[model samples]
Target: MADRDTVHYDGPAGGWGSLRGITRIFGKELPAPGVLDTLAHQNKPGGFMCTSCAWTKPAHHNPLEFCENGAKATLWELTTRRCTPDFFAGHTLCELKGWSDHDLEQQGRLTHPLRYDRETDRYLPCSWEEAFAAIGDNLKRLDPQSAVFYTSGRASLETAYLYQLFARLYGTNNLPDSSNMCHETTSISLKKVIGASVGTSVFEDFSACDAIFFFGQNTGSNSPRFLHPLQEAVKRGCRIVAFNPVVEKGLVAMINPQSPTEMLTGHETPISSHYLQVKAGGDIAAIMGLCKHVLDREDEARARGESVLDHDFIARHTHDFEAFTDKIRATSWEEIEDNSGLTRDALREAGEVYVEAERVIGIYGMGLTQQVHGFDNVAMLVNLLLMKGNIGRDGTGISPVRGHSNVQGQRTVGISEKPELVPMDKLARLFGFSPPMEKGLNTVETCEGVLAGTVKAFIGLGGNFLRAIPEQEAVAEAWQRLELTVQIATKLNRSHLVPGRAAYLLPCLGRSEEDRQAGGPQTVTMEDTFSCIHGSVGRRKPASEHLLSEPAIVAGIAKAVLAPNPKLRWDDWVGDYGKVRDLIEATYPQEFRGFNERLFTPGGFYRGNSARERIWKTASGKAEFTVPKELSATGFEDRPGRYRLITLRSNDQFNTTIYGYSDRLRGIEGTRDVLLINPDDMARAGLAEGQVVALASDADDGRERRVGGLKVLPFDLPDGCLGGYYPELNPLIPLSHHDVQSKTPAAKAVPVRILTGAAASG
Candidate 1:
């Protein structure tokens, strides 16, 4: 049975029309008529960044600032509901555990401060003054080093800038953010290959590309508003090659989300003339295949006395071409075909398209980052771009579609665990005192630290770290060890469930809600994927009058913790956060020039990272070649009945929250219980559509872990594989299991075994 609170519909999950099911982003029960005002702030006036995905959109004076998903994000944030401490009184930790994500949040916006009363098994309300004081008192209980501060992409640039400062000022460098969970690899790779970890292209880049390779991302669900650009690009004859295990309709739809003619008449813009389905972990091999095909064509051209390769660009702009070429030549055709889930014809077609295109763009999401060889997967694409001289030019570069709205922006304004993190270290030296020197934990490390008892306290600036993390049991164990858990968020989430022996749930303002103090109105900044820095403010009155903005919340905590009087007057910052901007200016030089003055300017500013020009800043000062791997994710190669299960968030989802039960594109609806399976695999297992089966972990060394049970159905999926919604399947993913180089959990690839009813009937 579905959790009692889940909204029920009578359709297949993915078949719902994009326009018909967008309301699922908010609780299906919430009321709304049409689009809401998106121009909530003036810090940038018409220069509003897309509030949805990291993908940029043209600044519009249009009233609908919110996309379908963006509306969900807004409505969910601005709901009239409130989940106060008294509400917690009715629900115990045990009771809440059985509640679905929607039910937990639908309980209402939390108004008063909340503290988990273990004796009562409920989180009773605590006052803000008491909550702040109690949190400080709890911090006084542990060594500052033992406390870990976690941040989410939901935080504003100002809040994050102040957050790192407070952690250092209070004496600890433990800052692990949502970045660790998603794109830690992109940050590590970009910072190493390029001088900075930001993208080179702007929104105009999409317009410039003759060929765009979209890997591991579904634009329709993730960036619905930005789909118009691709629609235009396709109309301009741009060739789009989509490489994902499950072919998303967004990549092939002949309709555009923004076009009224298309919307009124259901016309989708055609895309992905070539759809190559690569095995979950076979991205590197597929890239190698492309390289082989392109290089071989170059050889054929040379024999015919014709030019095929861009020899001049490769010689002057890049290095180690010979070694890279040798590796591609040495790779065997059979190996390539078997490793990648692609055929020679498909690979050849893709290579031909790339070779013909003048400007090429490679766009990827968690698909490229959430693998054991995820880093190698990206480097191959970068190598391909470099081979064709497709970088540093308009519309020609690698763009990693970020998960959260300002995930990359948070890093731009300085929230990082990078050991030699330049932003924080520079601020530390400029201000005073030594910043924490030890390499901080990424999301994976944070989980281990929690379980091992090395970490005792957790302070979150939005984001549900606990529920969002892989391995439910491991996360559950580490969470219980926290001496104090402080979550600064707008609504209830699973991270709040990780009650510290003493926990504090401090409600904060949402991006859609107005935030004002004695200083009139204030706006915070965010960084888009294009390295553009801009500002935003709230319009709808906050869900609750008691809510505090993230900056004010952080400032209040600092006041309570930095006792007796610290150098920075926390009170003054609370009084006027412009002073917070002053501190951010001092903390970050260069880009934020005349921080206060420039901010008042119409278009805020971009903290320029020019290496986005392909000026590799690595120790070698050249783009490094990451060696591809041969090992598939575990439990697959050596055992029968074991299969690879990749977890995904459906259309009505963003990270941890599930907005709707239906997935409009995949043709699923009214239920999230069905697992997507290849017809071949379904036949092999004798599983028919809607037959209930269990998804068990291959992680059982002594004890088995069951992620969830779902009805199997034949869907558009690759052979030898199955798929389902995530966090629900996250339990099967162990914390110990992650991409070694980047601490990102392999959410896209997990080794699992399918079982029939009653454990093993087959």
Candidate 2:
């Protein structure tokens, strides 16, 4: 193995660095023709949505509206390379299993449907009809409740709607999705506090806000396009405050690639005016500290015959204020300072900035949601927003920067495991079938069921489910117990390598590929993070003639599985995607009126939010003020030689997909095996920089979960906290370690001990 090089990057984000990334991906992946056409059409009006981040686009987009990662995602899908039957014929499943994730995907896109051959220990080409027939037969042999249908955020709105419809009509609601792993905490908490599971503000809100606070989100790398609005906000003298464990380069400064002067001068626009390096999993305490400061200021103002709190708004639009205030008053400042890893003066200063601003917007990411207290963390954010009447108004609200391109849309179009959230009666009236009323399995529940031998069949719409889930070895074992497993994907992933008794790999058309049916070329719709419904039309030809559209593949499976149902018009829906949109409009007329026509409009239409209109549909008929309890650090605090571990994505990766081994932002090159630790922690642990070590989880579950050969490097993180790349460290996170309410894996906060020298070698 080659040793990785570590260097500290001192320049601002974006500018030439981002441009170089775009050029490198295109040069490596698209050596063929149609490169310019593909680049021009990305994120344009009536063009395909970039299958990267869920950031909303402007009303009128430039020809080159995509960011660096967006270009990489597009190139990854439209690469000239192909993984044909001949390639699979030469490589056995056992051989492929040894290949790294980057190598497996570098083999290129899957060109045809494949089935595992047990005798040969390889995957061979198979007809789509034959594969679907066998899968349908297996599914028929098992109970509907025994089969779990999984959906990825990459699935378009139309595809997701049809997927849920099929799963519900099949007599089961066993639907789990990618959202369950990432933003389910935001959804669950927001629904309870604000009567909506989504962000209340639109993209335009960035322009009107006087202050913007970002927690646990790296705006420059994860969602590069968002920097445009943020940079603009900074230019207009807007205050930006960030609370994170690491001082991310993106939060420090950003250079707009679209600005000629910035590119020429190498000048950067400052992002965060204040940066607070809070401890990992200490967001709740930090937020509470800020709230306490605000309350103290309010008391002082009252004594001076002035006002700091929005008493009128709070009295008119919220509830539970007394309990909420009492809890904040009870929280001691010393405890807050210890737990948050920040000084009381710093928290007071942040509160002063927040108070001075007329309007503020709070944005967060997985750092706030992927923990044991994720729900409480999110609720605390809402509490701060509600105290100042930041929600349900222009220029102010809470925003969760979603990672997936259409994750919000997928949930909006009925991808939830909860049947009550989806209108079953309306769906039954439209489809002529009684949908199951009982709640079904989520991602975590599905895994448990599979391990218990209850779930026999699994179908993935679009994701590397096995690699994304926690407890890698155990999840792999549970997958093997399944009678049938099917994956609809654009390329090969680790999930396809781990097979069940009968496994099928079905290749589908990517977001950049044309989907031609009996009704000629069809356009799919997507919902962005801001709840804007827009159309995405791919102009490029399909990578392979054998590859099918997601809708076509889902429709085929539905046709085969629910055979002989006269009322179901799967063939008709497959012929024209408009029929799918028609049914969606019929099902959700209020939210999707004139769905087809509105999709053709410039920038599409907004899915109006009741919360934004100050019309709370919550059970209390008003916005809620939730009282957050005290938060405890991970149990490792008392355990000597143990540290809190946080799993993170490298700059070259999107979720589990690795584009390269290097993370340019953090200055690590040619490898992803380095662990970031605080200098103080390194001294206390008797470890030096660049030392190779082994990391072992302190789960106390009697299983030795460990990862070896990690190079340690001192970082600017808090003492007793360590950081490592995801999927590699996913094994250290137990499947049972998740939020109590959201069931999201606590990948952000894990307890582990580092072993060096002879201990590591053993």
Candidate 3:
């Protein structure tokens, strides 16, 4: 770990501290002079969406709708710094690899197209025509299955639609994206249980709900804008219950920066009424305990000829109710307490709160999804909601908080690895070509394919793929063997340095920059977490004159690689983005009906969820409940010195993008390599605060997975649990350690051994 210091913060989330944060960023990043004027338009009518989290905006927008993190994202995008060909010529690939992720991002936006010069170990400026020609040449030589088309959350819906179209026309379904990493479990699990792949609740539900139950979400760091709603709900007497390993400050209390009263008085509204520090990977067990409590109440109610359960609603709108209750009845309190790390009394109290509320909204984040039983965990939460008839009504439903800005929109436009998820038949009819029908590779499979020398090329629309992926050591080695690598991004990142034999770096316009075409300025749409699609138009000028809009870039690549079709003209789509939206409407008529017209509506349109209407598209035509065979959430046996490793993002970080070294909320500054463990676990491992240590995975794989020189920072985490930053701890996660169903990496629950003494010196 780098030189670091620790301090305690007693203030709530988003207070004067947030104001100071923005001020510090202005000095550090030195953004364009009129950046503040551009930020004012964020999430407003005829303005761009905040490029941070995928949280939805309120119907009546706030003046300063953007949060501190969102503002940071805007400033980060509009920074005055620029990375030109001169910067690339000055540093070799080997030398650039030595710089940290934060330092690389600080180098600013890329200004031109570049190609790797193997002889000089540097990247040289190249024309877009030459770059596209070279990529087309390399791709045609390889089997279509050997290539993987990857997209990040930054890609707009229009861009994503064209991207998937280009890939399918290229004769492959190998389109894997950022969703494969985070919310794949939510997508697959929700579809099975409720016949919907998205959260049923909307932003309005927060204000109308009687209670909100949070599972494994850190609202302060993930999406600070969400804190305002929680604050309002708390003030209005809505109950908030949280279950998480770390004592997330956001859930405990919040001082809304948008509220003039709170800002003037420095008053903090307590968010969560009851906070349960569930152990890492203990969400499933804890949820089971709550279900058992509800079941007990149902039994009592039945004896008295009354019912706490929604028997009428359950009978009419659900299936597998008896089977679900039977399993909950069979579960003993001892097993629940042992695995959940919560006592019977505590669960009963929480259950009482759930039972007392007329309407409750169930909310969760990656804490429940990035696990061995991620699907099971999410399904179990839905089961709890079904018992209380919380499925089809205002202020009641399941909400899986999505992390990326357009991750949901990308999936909406068919950027999935699953063949059955997208309407391939509809696409085939529209394009007059046979689209690929076979299943494609997800994130983990893509990595495995690369390691096996089967996947030869990777084309990334956006994202630092090498850093975002797990098994960093292995993937980094396998990445070098690829025949071609192409990255289209706004800034310089570590992934750009890991070029293949034939690599190209293409610069693209950011979300806040203007995109001009033949028709005029264009707007792209993004789907928020609640299935709401809205338009986003850039306010400022482009970062570089050479940069192209994502849609234009996709069209250019498609033109160069595929055979010209008389029916489809790539040039038409590039000149006017409305043409792209029109095609999207043609493909998915129900969802995108009146696509262009509805996109300009004040708050945009809702892509309706059938589950919310009590219309289950499942086999049984009703909501179903699922039960897990195993009680252990991590699926790992108890072993001494082995702890469940939970990877986390710092307050200064967003996904794989490192804004700075300090984590303000956690009180750790100047380093990102510190481990947070419980005081008891630290002593149990014969460790002390500030001790240099190492972590090694308990995976049975023959390969050693270890990262040393991590400074131990005692925290309020549950015993037998450890917390560390992602990418730094990704090396400790084995490739096979993922959900078998969704193939999402089990970053939340990796069995690892804390190494000290001799091992620490490695």
Whose lDDT is greatest here? Answer: 3
lDDT of 1 by residue, 293-317 (tens): 8998888889999866777877766
Q: Write the per-residue lDDT of candidate 3 for residues 362-441, one digit (tens) a residue.
A: 99999988898899889999999999999889999999999989999999999988889899998988889998889999
Q: How do all models score by TM-score?
A: 0.93, 0.98, 0.98
Instruction: Give the root-mean-square deviation of each candidate in angstroms.
Output: 4.0, 2.3, 2.1
Candidate 2 C-alpha lDDT tens digits along 496-577: 9988899999999988878899999999988888888888888788889999999989988888788577767888888888
- Note the Cα lDDT for every prediction shown: 0.72, 0.86, 0.88
Clashes of each: 25, 0, 0
lDDT of 3 at 725: 95
Count of clashes in candidate 3: 0
Which model is ahead, 1 or 3, in terms of lDDT?
Answer: 3
Candidate 1, after superposition: displacement of residue 214 in Å? Answer: 1.2
Q: What is candidate 2's TM-score against the reference?
A: 0.98
- Between the candidate structures 1 and 3, which one is better when assessed by TM-score? 3
Residue pairs whose backbone atoms clash in candidate 3: none
